[model samples]
Target: MAKAVLLILLSAYVITEMPQASWANRPEEAPKEKVTNLQFYFHDTLSGKNPTAVRVAQAPDSDKSPTLFGATFMVDDPLTETPDPNSRLLGRAQGLYGSSGKQEIGLIMAMSFCFVDGPYKDSTISLVGKNPAMNPVREMPIVGGTGLFRMARGYAIAQTHWLDPTTGDAIVGYNVTVFQ
Candidate 1:
């Protein structure tokens, strides 16, 4: 009886230890898509100011004015670092409106990071926007600095101010897109 029990236990162990061909023979995963370019746009609605006027002349290539995406700014500032380390830029804005009455305006700034989709998916990029703030115009500093900023992987984006609420200016909106 003991011999039979031992034989049964050994068979069980062997079966459990055996590797399955299906698991071991699974196909390899596909390569990930690489992010190559980052595009940005800025717009303002304040009187006498054109937010689209903001330019990044030092960009790697000429800027594209896409009617669909508004105006585009090339992310090619020689001084700006690339592959943003934080993978994001702080968006900030401020405005002053009335000269003789109660001056009032809204402010909004947002930073976003792009990421790849799940496995077996198209190489589409998605952005995560956050840190949006709005308040009455005070004498506070905007929040962050721009120009020649450093990012991850030595990649950088050239940022320019298109509106200043403290000066009673109106800005439309800003857009940033990372290309693969």
Candidate 2:
């Protein structure tokens, strides 16, 4: 009985250690990961005939506050290849930003970068985070995307390229890196 049990155990161990036969033709491997870097500028026009960004909401005390602490604006700003308004059009940034800081111009942004031309045509990337308006450069997270940028994750660096003190219009540059 003991010998029979030992033989059974040995047989099991031998079978487990034996190399199994592989498929005659293995399927092709999945596509490799891709990392993409994109640069563009947003033409945020506030007080023009055809405004891209417009004030949607505001608090009673917002007017009194220097930073417009409780103001919110909806934007459909044009995305350009360069800071110049006449530069090649890339897409649009459609979303909203609100003043979150009481003492400074801290904006909470939730927007999508919708592409219309080039390799990213019909794709969109979502960005949501706090933007320190006064900072020379601010970084925000690239949460996710759709179409060509599906399952994307990365970061975006924004710098104010130009500002109109009178109209409060601005051209902001964006550098985005994405991995999928």
Candidate 3:
């Protein structure tokens, strides 16, 4: 009988001393989400003294492939309210894109739009998708985000507002819809 009481006491102590990780902040349910629509422009500069994007690597056959397959570029482009680079600065789009299509110019983009202005300051939205360069418009997925955009899921429609054919510099307009 004494041994049974000691065992019960030990079990109670062990249960109370267990790690808190398994019990902390366990939400009973998901929070209601709000939908937001955002419009912005991304400036991808591949030329000039202060280019925002730079080629990082390429496959041996990248030069041979008209599509530049396997070529990768890291970018830190500016997000603006207008297609103009000098427009109101909204945020920065930082990430990497790689040429993945063998016959066509399909870019696998993985980037985050880090907002620096207004209510969304210090927040970010992550995007990942295949961008067909020749297409007039492309759609990308917003997988997730942080801060104000936590648990974000949505899509961004991209259209080339302007392109420098000779330099591959472009201003892409984005219309994004997000549920957070």
TM-score (C-alpha) between model 1 and the true structure: 0.24
Mind giving the per-residue lDDT tens digits that candidate 1 earns over 1-180? 999999999999999999776633655653443444433332333334434123222223222311111222222111111223233332312222111111221122222222222231222222222111232222111122222121222122223334464542332222332222
What is each predicted model's overall lDDT from 0 to 1?
0.29, 0.94, 0.94
Q: Please report how far candidate 2 places residue 142 from its true position, in Å.
A: 0.6
Tens-digit lDDT track for model 2 on 1-180? 999999999999999998865543333554667999999998999996999999999999998999999999999999999998999999999999999999988999999999999989999999999999889999999999999999999999999999997887999999999999
Q: How many angstroms is residue 16 displaced in model 1 relative to the true structure, after the best TM-score fit? A: 5.1
Candidate 3 lDDT by residue in tens digits, 1-180: 999999999999999999875423666554556999999999999999999999999999997998889999999999999988899999999999999999888999999999999789999999999999789989999999999999999999999999988899999999999998
Q: Which 10 consecutive residues of model 2 have the lowest summed lDDT?
A: 21-30
Any idea what lDDT model 1 has? Answer: 0.29
Model 2 ranges off by over 4 Å: 1-31
State which candidate, 1 or 2, has the greater TM-score: 2
